[model samples]
Target: MRKVLITGAAGFLGSHLCDRFIKEGFHVIGMDNLITGDIKNIEHLFKLKQFEFYNHDVTKFVHVPGKLDYILHFASPASPIDYLKIPIQTLKVGSLGTHNLLGLAKEKGSRILIASTSEVYGDPLVHPQSEEYYGNVNTIGPRGVYDEAKRFQESITMAYHTYHGLDTRIARIFNTYGPRMRLNDGRVVPAFIGQALRGENLTIFGNGLQTRSFCYIDDQVEGIYKLLFSDYVYPVNIGNPDEITIKEFAEEVVRLTGTDQKVIYKPLPTDDPLQRQPDISKAKEILGWEPKIGRSEGMKLTLDYFKAFSKEELRKSEHRDFV
Candidate 1:
């Protein structure tokens, strides 16, 4: 059997990736510092012989004993609320943590795929963000902490590939939702579901006019998996291209959850994108991948998953440690 190491193994995305890899029959090594990642997300795999976990931060040092064939570097505080509170840690992980993983990949002769994000576009001047467009970003803005960090992450990864000949892939992941997502993660999808479950009004920022595209978790994992094995060494945008306004998406959530609640509005955060969508032409042409799930189908599945959690479980909590 082949071997793989997954950082951020206990996060929403990381946990799902673990399930996929284990399903593929790889001996999976799961690592996280439990800073932002909850141990509960991955505890189910503890009894499995093919799965072993490490409570270690990738920003410091990463050591995986024996043969390793692949590294999926998904270890970062991804949400807006997350990166804002833990800006320095976010920068460190994207820079230092990524560097550590790249070095480990070189030592192990493993192909590595690091998770990038749509935030790199930084309130994109272009519509339906493609891989080639240089983003419109404010380096000193409040959100720049996450945006520039990912920008730097891409820079160093590409450098390693060019200078050191390390096998590398970068995935520009988009908004993905499904089970195991933190109800309080502050993203629109889960936040709406959590509010609906708790009988609270759905909160929409910025008059709900801004646009975004969301991808289902299964489709996202499939895209990343294909990108990992593909010969395309450049960055690939792996997300659904279906775009919708925040207001429309909120209405869908209210309808799906059968909640008769008023939609509330608030001022949007600084540096938040006015429009966001992925131009997946390269992913389709090169990887033979496009999102197979539609918004209604994906939303229903996600709402059902969130419905499983009790109102008490959906209650808001203070932000804890930074990863």
Candidate 2:
């Protein structure tokens, strides 16, 4: 059996990746700090003989014994709310955490894949951002902590590849959503779903004109797995290209939830991108991967998860009232 290490193994994407590897019969070692990631995500995996969980932060030196075949570095503050609250940790994980993982990969002669985000193309000047776009980011802005850190992550990853000739893959992931997403993470999908379930207004920033392309989690995970095992070295975009305005997304969520929530517009945050989409021509040609799930289907799955939570909460409240 091949040995694989996954950082941030308790996170939404990391957990799913862990499951994927484990199901494939790989001896998977999962490492996480439990700072932003929750244990519940990987608790069930502990019973599996092929899975091992470690409560270690990757920003420090990562010392995993034995030869590893693959390392998937998915550690970082992925959500905007997470990076905003813990800027230094976010930067350190992307920088120091990435460095440590790259060193480990070199030592073990293992193929490594790092999770790079589309945030690198900050407030992009291009409509559909390809990997070649240089980006139009303000390094000093409030969102710069996450953007700059990812940019540096890519830089260091390429340096390692060029200087050491290590096999490396980078996936420039776009907005992804599904179950296991934190309801209060301040991401648009979860935030809208949570609000609609509670009969609260769905808040839209800046006249609800800003657009985003969301990829379902399963499709995102499949794309990443293909890139990791493939012989691709350069960054590949993995996301759905279906673009929709914030207003349209909110309406869809409300419709799916069967909620009568009002849409409330608020001023946009600083450095919020007006448009975001991924050009996956390279991905299509190289990896033969494209998102298979549509937004409507994806939203229905997400809403079902949230609905379960809403019912649980309501049951608890009613019990208290009866008491």
Candidate 3:
């Protein structure tokens, strides 16, 4: 069987990728530092002989026992709350961690895929961002930590592809929501769901006018998987183009959850993107991939997953001190 090493293997996206790879009959090596990752997301895979787990930080040297067919670097702290709390670590992982992984991929002659984000298009000046658009990013802003980290990740991956002739792929992921998402991760999906479940008003920042296109987890994974196997070397946007205003999304959540809570407004955080919608032309043209799940269908599945959490778990995740 082909072997793959997935960093951040315990994360929401990484764990799902592990499941997908395992289903494809690959020997999977899962690695994570457990800093922001919950081991429960992947504990179910422990029984499989094809799956192995490593509790190690990728910012240091990354080593595998034998040949690796592929490597997916998904180890960085992805959410706003976690990255804001640990900004330096976020930068290091995107820079140092990515460098380490690229070196390992070279040594093993393995194809590597880097998880870039839509945040690289900081408060994008272009509508429905495409692959060729250069983003307007704030290097000194609060959100810059995550944005710059991802931007650097893409740059280095491309460099490795060109310089070392290393096989590499970059997926510029957009707002994705589904099961295994941390309820208190300071992302809109979980925050709104957690509030509605607790009967609290859904909080919206910046007048709820900011728009975001959310892709379901399954669709996002499928896009990434296709991109990994495709021959595209440049960055590809993997997200649903179905855009919705924050206000509209919150209302949708209310209706979906059958909640009576009202919407509350708060000051929009600094450097928060006012609009986010990916132009997935390349994804469709090249990978022949587009989101198969609609919001209503996807949201219901996500709600069902969150609904399974105990009341105490919901209460604990309902509030997080982002500062």
Candidate 4:
């Protein structure tokens, strides 16, 4: 069986990747520091004969016991709430942690894929961001920690690819939501859903005009998988291009949850992107991929998952980094 090691294997995205790879008959080794990642996201896989886990922080060093065919470095504090609270750790994981993983891939001769985010395009001057667009990022802003770290990550990955000839893939993921997402991750999705569940008004920042394109988790996973296996070594925007404003998206969540609550407005966070939509021409042309799951269908599955959370969890104002 082919062997693959996945970092952040307890995160929403990483755990799903584990399930996908294991289904494809690979011996999947999972690793996470349990900082922002909850083991519950992956506890089900602990008993599988094909699965093994490491509870080490990738920022230090990563050592897998056996030969590996692939490495998916999905281990970072992805959400704003998590990254802002632990900014240094976020920077380290993206910079030092990525460096460590790249070294590991070199030693094992493994193909490595790093998870890059749309935040790298921070408060974009472009409408729909494509791979070639140089981003307009605020290096001194509060949100810069996450954005710059990823930018540095992409830089180093490309350097390794160009200089040392490493087999690398970078997936510039856009906003994605689904099962296993933390209720208080401070993204629009869970915040709206939790408010609807707990009988509170959904809060929108900046007049609810700021837009985002949300890719369903399954579609995001499929696109990442396709990118990993494809020969394309450059970055690919792997997300749904279906864009919606914050106001409309909140309404959808309320409608799906059968809630009567209204939406309340708040001040927008500093450096928050006004618009985020991916131009996935490369994803379509190269990987032959575009998102298949629509928001309505995806929201129902996500709603069911959030509904399963214990009542205690639902009552909390925010659940990030407190687990």
Best of the candidates, TM-score = 3
Tens-digit lDDT track of model 1 for 195-298: 77888888888878899999999999999999999998899999999999999988988898888999988777887889999999999999999999898898
What's the true lDDT of residue 196 in model 1?
A: 79
> Over 4 Å off in model 3, which ranges?
320-323
Of 2 and 3, which scores higher on lDDT?
A: 3
Please write out the lDDT profile of model 3 over residues 85-147, one tens digit for every residue.
Answer: 999999999999999999999999999999999989898999999989989999999989889
List model 2 lDDT by residue over 222-315, tens digit each.
Answer: 9999999889899999999999999998999888888898898777888999899999998899999999999989998888877778556633
RMSD of 3: 1.1
Candidate 1 lDDT at 55 equals: 93
TM-score of 4: 0.97
**Per-model RMSD to reference:** 2.3, 4.2, 1.1, 1.9
